[model samples]
Target chain A: MKLREQLTALLTSLAGVWIMSYAWIVLKLGSIHVPDAGFLPFLCGAALAVLGVAWLLALHWTKRKEAPAEKRLWHRPLSSLLLMIAYGWAMETLGYISSTLVFVIAWQQIVEKEKWAKTLSIAVLSTLAMYALFVHLLKVPIPSEFFLR
Target chain B: MDIFSGLLDGFAIALTATNLLFCLLGAIIGTAIGVLPGLGPAATIALLLPITYVIGTPVTAIIMMAGIFYGAMYGGSTTSILLNLPGEAASVVTCIDGYQMAKKGRAGAALGIAAIGSFVAGTLAVVGLTMFAPPLAEFALDFGPPEYFALTTLGLLLAVTLSGGSIIKGLIILLFGLILAMVGLDPISGKIRFTFGSIGLQGGFDFVTLAMGVFGLGEILYNLESTMKTEIVTTKLGKVFPTLGDWADSRWAICRGSVIGFFVGIIPGGGAVISSLASYAIEKKYSQHPEEFGQGAIQGVAGPESANNAASSSSFIPLLTLGIPGNAAIAMIFAALMIQGITPGPFLVAEHPDVFWGVIASMYVGNVMLLVLNLPLVGLWVQMLRVPYGILAPVIVLFTTIGVYSTQNQVFDIYAMLFFAAVGYLMRKLDFDPAPLPLAFVLGPLVERSLRQSLLLSGGDPAIFVSRPISGILMVIFVLLIVGQTIFFLRRKWKRRCCVPVPPETEKSL
Candidate 1:
């Protein structure tokens, strides 16, 4: 029977294997007196590999499989992941207020889709608070252009 | 007279206008983040670690940040009780009975009991912190690297107790976290660990990044996967106060929890979860109606809430005394202390009395601030529950990235955050936990430094670890912890195979 685990599970398993492989390569760098750095990562990688094996084994033992895979894409929380990446990319260029304003607006209306006035009110106030807290008060520099930046 | 004089000195520092205002701000910010779903106390402290650098006076910064810590403890139950989302580790127990209470339309009473219990616990905890802290520091002063390594091993072993559904899975995640902790440059040799030849890895994974990914972003991913499990849809119905008997019934539970939690929190590896679970079990074990535990007993909420708050406060004793943080938030506090060129240890009390007692005094003020912050703002926080994951999720990521970037002015942190986000998402998929990662990242350098120092001190003798009395005791505890958890793991696997419910692992994963 086909397994129902999501893209996340597949990625996790792949990562486990890859990290373990990297650990092996690092471990092989020397014979005796391998640095503590090498020792830790090798251990970490082995842990990952063990995890991968255990996860697969548990799935096999459980008898019941995960939910169907076809439905995974439809439920990927795509809006969230994409919007987040965009926010990160845009923040430095736009500054804190501008990017935050745009992100908040897109998030509220597009993702949350609340009424216009409420969305606008929350978006403006939150960005302003973040600005005052980080940039003005704490003196942490934030990108300041995009919104009504 | 001595106690009163000391408290008076503490109040003199805490009562200053500057400290008071900072304390209020810290409580407000801490409570805000704690109430926000997915941003646990560890991540919040980790995120704020960079900012604490900007504030003048290590004493003032520590005082204020300490406010944020227990403020979050006070804030956590609001969400768990109202939303059925265990917003913080300690609040997991709250969700069991507190959420059920909310579902049954007793959220007001549950919240009321939580606040009152937390306040009682906080007040009592300050007494414990004051009494035990100095003496503890005196004892810890004699300790050395061997003791430290043993303590770290014991701590890592206890991670098994924090396991949910699978002990092996918990240890696996912890090991991964330990390995990730190795990424930065080697402390002893100055050689890079797991940088994979990248500059980013040279510095190693910051607690902020690991915490941001594993606890904060990872939580967002988990919520996305199982939004259906949350009880927010049941009804946002709630009032703002508790009945008289509700308070009466919980008063004893709160007192018991405060005492238990204070003692437990003082122990190096024991923390809020232990207190919470222990308090809940005690309440269940001795209650007139033990059967009502999973069905939203008010005592469950009161005892656990008190225990969590007390634990959060008393943990400072260890961090300030032994230079060992009992939890991740304290670890960040340690980093903040280091940034100020201050190392917390036995002499810290005598040398940096202001930072020491200032933080101790601030807890009293912070607890009061938390109570004030929690009450009238209860409505606001519950409103936060309705903010919907879709809107809040992106903001969490955005704040995380910007926060990380703004610290170093390094654009690479954004990528690191993303990589961890992906790794975090995957860990959840494979049923791996992230709780141990921050602990590992925080303790990694300390362990690395200690191991090398021990080896150097003993002319490369590994036996040095077992040579000390303190170290030997820690080793024994470590062994017992591993053995106990192995049995637990086997029992759990047997249960899973048998299709028995495991109480949803609420309190320990607490």
Candidate 2:
């Protein structure tokens, strides 16, 4: 836990430095009187850096304490996230209907381990429901299949 | 316009078939989400934000969103009473006595009082809003750029302090949000800042997409971590109406909660959670039988429920009058207003009276809708809890994806949503509250624009912030908050080092 906190603090400071540097070198932090676009960003970056560094120093000075490890039920969430990325990519390529049907089925079967019949019905229903709602009712321009286009 | 006249005109607008239908829809959806334990009002609103595009008119869109906002307050107590599981953070206090009431076979009474109290408080707070917002906006018309800057900055700072975490962590997140807000074309110069040459980044992050990503998808992912399912208490609801004795005990509690909630909700960082907790404390202190607080006390069920609902209504005061969001949910509405091209501020009352008053009047109708929905139709809401999260999670993901995609028809936006979803999940795991991030992000542009304008007006004089009366007072408060927090932090640290006793083994080693 302590290590994670320190690392997070370190990353934050590093990010601050990068943003500050970018604003200074590229955007040109002009005088406050004639402030440029980078002016507020620069100030925010500086403050973030200070806070991050102060946190780091404070963490360093304090005695390290250990916390109980959170039981790693992370696999399910992680797998779903990866599947979602795939779903997004597939939606663009294969189009909304096919991709959604497949994604829902995959999540219910793989992550949730549900029965096949119920999963298939839900997948089909939800996909068609969204399609009707977004494309037809609301007139949202969902991506279509390459062949259809 | 005179208050009565404005309200009459507002009723005319709100009573239209279109607005009334959507208001009912919003109420039903709001109550459903409120009954469900995991999905919150903020996430639900964020998920539905894209509907504003096709929802015909901003007035109706805002009316529905507002319904969802206060309707959640009415519905949250149902789960607290029946299940001992708070549907949202604000109802956590209700679980103590409300669940007890259920065990005593008074679930119907607890539920009844909660609904009635919420309705009363919601109506009272709406009255307060009707009276106060116009005058406040009229006064705010005198505010200059410096004052706006100070007010927004103070709002952001208050959010940071009241966000409930390490002050440093909250500040870091706040700055991070401000930086993210800078990632588009400069308002004044039209020069892009941090797009990195991507065409997609030029227009900056869509408020709807980012919100859907951070609050909607992120929350679903976090809830995905806990695989354990919650069991609903199956105690029979005898009669969904409070007795006269119960009402007599709670009448004062309801009134006191409404007043406390309304006042607290006006503060920048105060909202349903704090107000409900405060109401509970006050009710306990003043109750004739304080010992019965956590033992099925009707006052316990009534007070916090009323306060949370009242707070939900009154929190809109800041957003409507000052163009500042009081909390995360209000921030989403603030974004909705901006998306509709309606700049919410002092001029909102004068310039867009239809929207200003239409939403206010819709609350009256919506509160009644909530009361009807919550009392006799509560069993339907309980049925919602039975739907397994395994099924609900995927549907939420689909909605979030479709919602984000429908906003701009960009695959890139979907990717951005995914990215923020991951970031939000990480933030949750690390104990960093993501609430301030969106609030800061929403306020960031306003802050920067106001700050630059103020400097330009003063010819780069930083003293302009201190010279003006309103801005000066706000700045003083801002500085004191920082200094006070710093002092408190240091004193705690010093005490930890000096006063904490060491074990003999550690002392010998030293």
Among these predictions, the greatest DockQ belongs to 2
For model 1, the superposed segments whose C-alpha errors exceed 4 Å read A1-79, A91-129, A143-149, B1-7, B96-107, B163-165, B224-244, B267-269, B291-296, B375-377, B386-391, B487-510
lDDT tens readout by residue for model 1, B1-510: 244566678788888999999899889877877787677777677666666668788888888778888888888898888777777778888988998898788887788789889988998999899988877877887888888888776776565454334555566666666667767666655665556678767777666666666666766765665535355635544555667888788889999999998988876557787899899999999999999999989999999999989988998987888776767677778777876889877778878877888788888888888887777678877777676666567556556766777768766777677667767776666555666666666676677567656766777677787778899888877878777766775676676657865443231211
Tell me the whole-model lDDT of each prediction, alpha carbons only.
Answer: 0.73, 0.88
Pairs in steric clash, model 2: none
Least accurate 10 contiguous residues by lDDT in model 1 chain B: B501-510
Model 2 chain B worst lDDT window (10 residues): B501-510
Best by lDDT: 2
Q: What is the C-alpha RMSD of each candidate to the true structure, in Å?
A: 4.8, 3.1
**I-RMSD for candidate 2:** 5.1
Residue B334 error for model 2, in Å? 1.1
